[model samples]
Target: MNRNKDKAWYIADVGDDLIYIAEKLNTKANSEDYHFENELLMLKEVLETLESLECLKEHSE
Candidate 1:
């Protein structure tokens, strides 16, 4: 098992929540929404990176 599995899952959960909130708002009509969108994007990247690391750890073990 990946040592960071818990952390990875937590980050992914947060990212999912952010994405859901952004989608629910769907504030693309307003420029202010860009900030949330950008944050969601960054969080997605973090989630992906953590997931990848977790995969690597699993494979190594």
Candidate 2:
């Protein structure tokens, strides 16, 4: 007998939350200090997270 487990779909909940916060900060507080840095960091994190998820997806397929 052969058996296979179902794979779970990937979701970026953390990254999406970060993205939403970053977007709001960047747009709502244009003149605030450290806003740019935080936004950039959030974007970087999102990109890295997506990349890792993609790698996992490919491996699972």
* Best-performing candidate as measured by TM-score: 2
Q: What is the lDDT of every predicted structure here?
A: 0.66, 0.61
The digit string of per-residue lDDT tens for model 2 on 1-61 reads: 1112221222446546576976778676776555466667766776777787778668867
**Cα-based TM-score, every candidate:** 0.44, 0.55
User: Relative to the unseen true structure, what is the C-alpha lDDT of residue 23 in candidate 2, on a scale of 0 to 100?
Assistant: 73
- Candidate 1 lDDT at 34 equals 41
- Model 2 weakest lDDT span, ten residues long: 1-10
Poorly placed runs, candidate 1 (over 4 Å): 1-34
Off by over 4 Å in 2: 1-10, 22-26, 29-34
- Report the lDDT tens digits of candidate 1 across residue range 5-56: 8656866676787776666557664545444556567667767877776787
| Candidate 1 CA-lDDT value | 0.66
How many clashes show up per model?
0, 0
